[model samples]
Target: MEIVVAADASEKGLGAAIMHRFPNGRDKAITHASRAHTSAEKKYSQIEKEALSLIFAVKKFHRMIHGRKFTLLTDHQPLSIFGCKKGVPVHSANRLQRWAIILFTYDLPMQYRSSTNFGCADALSRLIANRQPPTEDAVIASVDAEVRRLFIDALRSLPLTAEKI
Candidate 1:
């Protein structure tokens, strides 16, 4: 029972994707997403964002991983230090110290993986909100489910564009 986790965060939000791998190499995935607090969005340092993403992941899935020693993969190089013989970053914010303590509670071995290699988790963390135009605009999308279905059906009837083809 080996659990591999990757987490990433953006100003708009944070997300983590989890994959559980069995002895035979079979695996399954779980994804977590959440909105960022306005404060974290405006002022969280780079390191905090990285640490927080992992924290969010671990806490969100603690039930599945609490008693086990799991591998934590992250794109931020500094985070890997927490798992090394060295030491956690002491110069950064005190919040980092608190986070490190929380992480230490679990026997987590952190590894630094490039975002490319951690695609699933990386993608989970970088969600952008879909903002509709203001109400005053000419195109207020229909609230009626039937109308929306009809509109989608109409689009499906059109020929595919070159790119789509």
Candidate 2:
């Protein structure tokens, strides 16, 4: 299974999605996540906002993706420099340098994708967060349910299952 994480950030929020890309080249959304930024985060520069979004996505999906390699897609082109292939920047903000150190631990190769082709994450980032956000357990349960449903759907579509029937 090929895993791709797409992340985006807006002034209001950050959004990300973990996508499973089949060998046949179809992409499936394994899970999606978004959250409103804190007042301080909202004041971050554009690059900082983008970096934060990537960090959020990586940490959110860490369990499924930790030790393994994956591709990271971001609309912000400058982020490509932060991939494992490129060494950490020497002259960045303290906050960014710290984030880069954290990201380096993950085996992800960053790729630049244009905004028009990145609607999923873009829309997510623009969404208004609720006054009362769902509990972490509820969010996990929802993602688990979606993954289960997708697994069952894939199984049903297999020719072996059809033959058994």
lDDT for every model? 0.74, 0.90
Give the top-scoring candidate (TM-score). 2
Which pairs clash in model 2? none
Residues 1-165 of candidate 2 have per-residue lDDT tens digits of 989999999988999999998999777898899999987898899999999999999999999899999999999998887885567678888988888888889988898989998988889999956665678999999999999999999987777865576
In model 1, pairs of residues that clash are none
- Candidate 2 at 41: error in angstroms? 0.4
lDDT of 1 by residue, 47-158 (tens): 7888888888889889878988888888889787666645666676788888887888888788787877766666766664655334643344545666889998998888
* Candidate 1 segments exceeding 4 Å error: 22-27, 128-165
Candidate 2 residue 150 C-alpha distance from true site, Å: 38
Worst 10 residues of 2 by lDDT: 156-165
**Model 1's lDDT to the true fold?**
0.74
